[model samples]
Target: MKNPIAERITDFIKNYHPFSELSYNQILQVANTCKVIYLDKNEILFKIHDEIHDSFYVVATGAIGLSITSDSDDVLIDKCDEGDVLGLRPFFAKDNYLMTAKAREETILYAIPIADFKPLALQTPAVLDFLLQSFASNTRNPYDKTHKGKLISENVIYDDHNNEIQYYQPISYSTDPITAAVNDIVQHVAQIMSNRRIGSIIVQENQLPIGIITDKDLRSKIATGLYPISVTLDQIMTTPVITVPENLSIAEAQMMMLKYNVGHLCVTKDGTNQSEITGVISEHDVVVSQANNPGVLLKKIKRAHNIVDLKLVRDKMTDLIQHSIDKNIPISHICSIIGELNNAITKRVIDFAIEKIGTPPPSKFVWLDLGSQGRKEQLLLTDQDSAIIFDDVATENHENTKHYFLHLAKIITKKLNKIGYEYCPADMMASNPFWCRSLSDWNSQIRKWIQNPGDKGILMTTIFFDYHCIYGDENLANALTETINNEIENNELFLAFLGIDALKNPPPLGFFRQFLVESDGEHKDTFDIKARALMPLIDAARILSLHMGINKNTNTSYRFAKLAEIEPQNALIYEACNEAFLELLKFRTEEGLRNNSNGRYLDLSNLSKLDKVKLKNDFQPISEIQEVIKNRFQLTYFT
Candidate 1:
């Protein structure tokens, strides 16, 4: 049934343009599906590149800021007050939002569903013209002078003494004169390449490029005698060539080559290889195009022999993180790249630490990364939380084995500290005897935690359960995970306790929809984003994954995705949780980068009205998930 509130919203919006042209019944139908959303000051309605909503918003009271983020700078594009329709362009363009809409003050919005309003738009020329004119002007309101003649998310050039980033420059490639038919013999192709003094040549079919044969291909295939000189060019050519349009940008070509692990790209009339050949751009071409890329950074990391060199590479990675965020890359993709790089750094540390310890490990031991590192969610430098579990030893060697690992852990942790990872304040490090133990000892401790479910046990479970073996014996980590999941499956009370713990931090929205900021202390009137916002999602995923017998997928997003697969009935809810967690992570990382601190406590006053609202809106999933946990675990019956 349509709410009575829709009728009131219909009365309100009918006075506005587009809506003004519609009849009472026509506007009422649009309002029937309208959602009335309340925004606390600084709440975000949508972000740049976010999927367009089925509905667009009209601010009934208060103000909204339509802004763009460039190089981490938030630029206000427009300040929308009463009767200002926001985010309507995405609906017309059938694309994601190009700018973010955030509440500038405590606001009430009538969200008119485009599914119903679209037909009305077609029927009314004035309404359509109003939208078309406003969109063409790059302004939300045609008559308003505050926003005009500039794109949302305008590209800002940055040039400093230390670094210069070129946004998008087209790649230059060698065009014409290098081509061979498929029937051309290998010897003939090689002779033609030598005559031209080029390293590669295109093999063609019809008038279009079909494949490429490079120096490496000839070396591996002909020099190694895998193919004879008499063989046709088709035999040695790398088929299904990677192609890009002639207008490919230097950055795009570089990233594409790195992503595909190719030394050369076939430039074609169209982007596909079936089109006529235009030119070829090689890896060397891409390298000459740019100096600061992940490829260069990764190469530096891999070649570094000392911790000092690694530290320099690590510093550059911080800049890369900022660049990635500023460019609006997908958070998931950034997380994977950063996580892989972090794992590489840690692996090198382990190798060096083992060498420094002066002896190969007495037995097989797995290095466990706890907390954020384990989940692959960490972006900025944080405390080290790790453990080591070795194979069980004979009674006589037990003490000695433990001592050996402890010494190695100390060296590794110290090196990591020097590289920017601080020591865990709680001593949750491998150097701690309690954490570095034999496989049997580790298994026993985990059993006790699940069997006895106390406050300490739950706390320990929260930290340790998200472990991933960054470097070491995978079987050992797998076995422990199996045992932990098995133990939890048989224990219903333990899941209930975990569920209760997950609800410890209620959704951070108050009765008036204001942020429930920290009342006092160093972060007075600040939002505890980590504790109040992030932890609830993390804790819920861990507990639910345990209950469902899903083991080893420690990432919050991954856990929710797995949950969605296991329980399709609740897939939408789980999927929402995944999206919320990622968005929150991005929010925290950006805040941290801006303040140069762990992005945990956000000063509520510093947020724009739209940002405040966006933060509050994310809390909806937390409340919904907590309710799911309460019902599933029957938590209402708990004391």
Candidate 2:
């Protein structure tokens, strides 16, 4: 017997995900069991710690607000409008409610029974996967025994400034950077550069960097007839000068240039445009900074003709990382050099891909590195995760534009695979259609995730939000980040949902304060250093940085340090998190080098007493930071 109300509810439920993945007959059958309920504004549907209901909910009309209790008030974490679903967490876990659901205004909801939905999901793989992803709050469950995120390794080099020891040491730059006024003619600036034997000149206004002109500019803009020699230097100069701090190391300087796709970096008093210029380092300056060092490796990467050349350079980089670890150089320093070298390889690969395609990109685009690579913490050769963001196109040209970029990404990813950065297991690479999108489309996609974060959306945001521009126009990445931060500003509740995910992993120790080793599996006695020790801190840093609107950095340690400065009251805890992360990172890198494995799982039998103590000490910070997050996001009611 078909009830009219149940039939009407079926029409609405059939449109959204998990439901959309189901057949019409299955949907109507589930809808027949739904219990429609109405509520006035500010009425409670469920409270935190309430017993799990047999039925999850879908909004039939009006809206529902989801919130977590904090101190004395309810903090809204997400809003469910018409057709949006809520209470799906019950489908995956037989636990109490972690949030309160109430009507924001007069609302109507169709409570869809999980008992009815679960059997259907089990029969339909697509439906099961959607529910699983949403329940887990990530692409896959982080704590799953089978899903140990590991990658195969071959090995990669970085020559230091003439010697490896001097690589990260502070670099020397020409303090007397040649400068010109905005009103100076290009011919006059070129004349000054020629007389001074300098290849570059900065254009200044009131002792502030406005732009820069170099020999390349002279050749491209004047000699090639792009601009007249008599035109002002401003007419030919590259604007928005990329600035670096006075203490930049050779590797750091090189990375900045690669990051911004520039040849020269203006060193300033305060490392910003608001400060006075102190010095400058050019591409030639970097190449000659060290004859047989990382600069050499960088030059080789830049000058490589094909994939084979890049592969050789990459193999050498592995030796460099091993040597750095053997020498006991700080893990942070090793990361800067290795991360930059990795970027150099990626930049060169992108260059080769473009050449191989036999055509230039239709418009500007940016290549974004996600996850560990985005954080510059990819010390070992692991899975490569990336995405592409191109400038928006017209409706008519969208498909063709997307097709062209997809072809380019396929070539780029294929070459990267040959070079030893194996394909990401989950296929989270630029080559995938979902990963490669126009800027406007990406914005829309991100906004959708931000608005309806739930569990799955939070997972996607955590992965994608910490993006670093590996190649192409950095402005595109910046524009995308700006949009993300802006949307987050309006939807403050997204961070609370993110916080819920952050608290998913509990303290790393067991009841007896022992190292919590795996009890059952192939590696039964081994410890998952990544999931238990590392991810807790990483998640805390990410949530805090987002809450504070710190979008400029992606590094875990760097984020913790920044949070420390901003909240001096919590400095000790923040500093502890940073130190623990670096120590743990160094330990993992060494383990990987020793075993020739991904270094994620560590056997307890191999650890020395001192090593065990050090590892245990680092675990304390995990508890401290989790408490900070629980209190900060008002997630006290959560755990």
Candidate 3:
């Protein structure tokens, strides 16, 4: 007898190829033997090593994940959604399934019998080729080592050997650097070098190499009185500057630096200095090209004099972050190194701004980083949130003091914007008069927020509480933090309100185990990774840390680690949360780098099976931690 659901099943299959290639009668015949299966979210349809099912399944609704489990470790391989097919193990020899197929969300699937479909696939060349292509593209069989298989060995994709070869291409050099005429006066040459900070100013005439005047040459000759300061550069400059071609490799550049015992190399259009000076490559540039060590990066940041120079350094920082993740470096060390570089960049911007202003600060003050920067966990370039708190001024001179600091902050932020640190969209920068205030005004504001603790007050508190002294008097920032801490200790209700705010997003998994993706807005159908995944963890960490009277730590991961130590019973859970947070952060950063956005919105359809599993694993701890918070604080009463 014909199955009643056969026509509907064929209709669904006919929409997707190579089923669409089949005649309607053929598709209907195949669908008659199909089984309709419903899977609850997370329910496993097939496990690793299980015998191949005779039927291949097509997703009719929701999503499915294919994963591999070995030695108690599970890795997701691929994900399939509506119209995507799974369970093709029967296509090959009678081998066991290489991966487990599971329902990512509550899913309805149509299982088409291989007996009915194989003859059609074999008869049609296009249909057979399409199936092969689909199998290869699917995330399943990631470990398959055969020719152009879906699963290449994991080592090839993620291990150090593969990443080193893939990410570290040879560095490029600038050719035909600007050169000075040999007979140029000593003072003029000195001015040029100081302006450009080029260690050696190439002396050329008619685009021919002549000599070079480096900082060393000036200090050794003119400064030491070996040669009069009024002498021409030709008198003191080293003759016959070493020249290289534009295509110098990092290895070759380093070799030249060693061979000549020189700090700078002049690159010409041709290999010889007879050609025009194209560019200069310094030893410092070579070092920056090689690695992102903190000492090396810090030195590079300090030497950056302009926005263009700083942007280059910032790009290197991104490379550093990717390298750290690829190498499996400790997250704590990565954060510290990145934090130091970020702080150094800001400090350089301030120093440059001060030089531009051509005046000393009117009074002492502290520059406060108000958000992730303050927390010291900002690995990616996100929004800039900062404020200025100047030293207390005389009542009559208060307005003048505030104005001076605001002007300074404006200059600094402008430079920062040029260097790729986007201005805070909400205008939460030091340039704002409300943010650039004297110490007394800041204190008053904190007091009001602490006493009131309304929605706006809570929002303000969240930003301000993370304040780290980026520049200026550390003591001033410390004093402010002490004041806020004292207020929080006094007002227990404020803690409750913070707790209420922390629980706003809750865990992302719904009762049916489906991801609570954003329903509307610019992020519609995409996961709000920040507010939904990362922020809840951050908020929970902050509230718990505050309740424990811990103020020294600001990073979410560190807070969880400290909490684990303080509360040993919940140590396992907190440690899990910390690990999950790091994984999620790394995932978000990689996604952001790929998509060229903030990495907050994730398209659920694009997640690989392995990525889906890792993400889902993260959710388990999130759900568990929220439960702990609920039980410990009795947060349900407030909610």
Candidate 4:
């Protein structure tokens, strides 16, 4: 006898595909004939070459492994988790099952009758097309050879309609640009441009543009009578001009101009200026197309009347980050630009919050960004880790001043949370009264952590040491950093303690060079690339740099390079660490862009052999640096 739950299953399925085209009564009829099957972990649902069953299965819970068999050996093709449909061979052809289906874990599946589903497939063209495409992409019909021309058929079926997907259309630019030869006299070029009323002319060699002579060049060089008008174009022209492809978008063109601080972009055939000049995109052209230039974005931030407008600007910032990455812009430069923008957004949020409170800040205060944001290395959206520190007030006004800053921190943090920077899960944010303190209180807290030197104190230092002033007075942050450095100079034990903490997580590799994946958790079996690999290097750099009494440098790579220069004996090792850190960051950024996540956890199973090798190479520096830390700090005796 079939379960009564089958009718409910049919109702759910009917809302989604070929089943939707079926008559309500007919769907119920099919559902009533379906069977509900349960399997424990590692149990086989069906084997290859077995006679096809009367129905296919939809995973109700847990996961199933769909695999193909070759010479009696089964190779897993894909893991079908919840909502995945599997085993649909009988409807198309009367053949034995080509693959083996096994339960990846304890699972419940709903099996629908093929006979009843066939009528719906015939009635719905969308359903039939989707089924055919899914089968072609997922099944073992490598030589089935049908549906080869239907590009995006599988995408149409699987892509979620509601997700915000960015459109990647080619940029528009001015075609048929003015050009000249390198040997051409400036006077002659000026005559041609003046006759045509063009402001600039590109100078080329063998059809490849090499330089540009603009109106500014003529005014600054010739009109000022500094350079003779008879001088060759090369004498007055700016060589190695910025070049962009014809397809650059308005947003990209604007970013490029702002990034390089240039007014003209030479449009080349392939964006390299190695080929003939095809067009030009001037600063004016981009400004005309884009209503939200940097100036506009900045003004909007200033004039933002509410959190809603600020949210819109923050969303635009996310788009700009993606654009920067796609344009192959330097990640460091991108981080600085976005950091300033993010800081501006925070400032605006603070202003809006203060306005809403109907009171100005009771005292001068600074908002400090801790951890990655402090280091200016935050490339992806991560948790907010910050603190608020105000000037010490008179005893009479101390409590009242603290209360005002706390309220302000709460408002600012709330707006930040709404803008996609998730609240720190660990409560390590400015909103916490413990974090929102006066300058005197912050100094006292740092002294206690430095003197005590316990696990909690070390952890606090790890978070606080990365502090970069995101908003408010820089002098306050500088004073705090200087006080800490002065204190650290005398506290050799504290530096050793920090070094030991840095060595806690060894390189994530086992004896046989296999990845040391997490044994248990929600992310069980996944490699924690951030914690195990990246953090070790970051922690080491901070500890070593602080010990060297170096200040004002927050970047890990720059810190390591500085360390290398100061300590020539350790130069090679430090240089290797710097390179490895950059490589890992680049890898993580690429992965994050691909999967749309923090890119902290990596799926080792899906990594290419080349990437695995590259990742393993980073472990060498980790091991070497840890040894250096242990030896230099004499942590062996302490451990």
TM-score of every candidate relative to the true structure = 0.59, 0.56, 0.57, 0.57
Q: Write the per-residue lDDT of candidate 1 for residues 1-639, one digit (tens) a residue.
A: 666877888889888766787888888888888888999998999987688888888889999987654323354656787887777866667866666788889999988778787878877877875665455434456544454333221222222221222233344568873988999998988998898888899888897888899999989999999989999988889988888766555655755676468889999887777788888998877665444455466667677898997898788777767766875655664565566667778888899998887789999999999999888888988899999999999989999999999999999999999998899999999999999999999999999998899999999988999887888898999989878877887688888888899989989887888788888888898888999999999999988888887774677887898899899998988988888888889888888889987888887777898887788788899988888899999997662
Candidates in order have lDDT scores of 0.79, 0.79, 0.76, 0.76
Give the clash count for each candidate.
17, 11, 14, 2
Compared with the true structure, model 3 gives a TM-score of 0.57
Off by over 4 Å in 1: 1-292
On residues 110-170, what C-alpha lDDT tens digit does candidate 4 reach at each position? 8977886777777777566556534534522212244222111111110112211122222
lDDT of 2 by residue, 174-221 (tens): 998988899998887888899999888988999999898988889888
What TM-score does structure 2 among the candidates reach?
0.56
The model with the greatest TM-score is: 1
lDDT at 15, model 2 = 82
Q: Worst lDDT window (10 residues) for model 3?
A: 155-164
1 or 3, greater by TM-score: 1
Question: Candidate 1: lDDT over CA atoms?
Answer: 0.79
Tens-place lDDT digits, model 3, residues 35-112:
999999999999866889999988899988876542123445467778777787687448776677899999999988
lDDT (Cα) of model 3: 0.76
Which 10-residue window in model 2 sums to the lowest lDDT?
A: 148-157
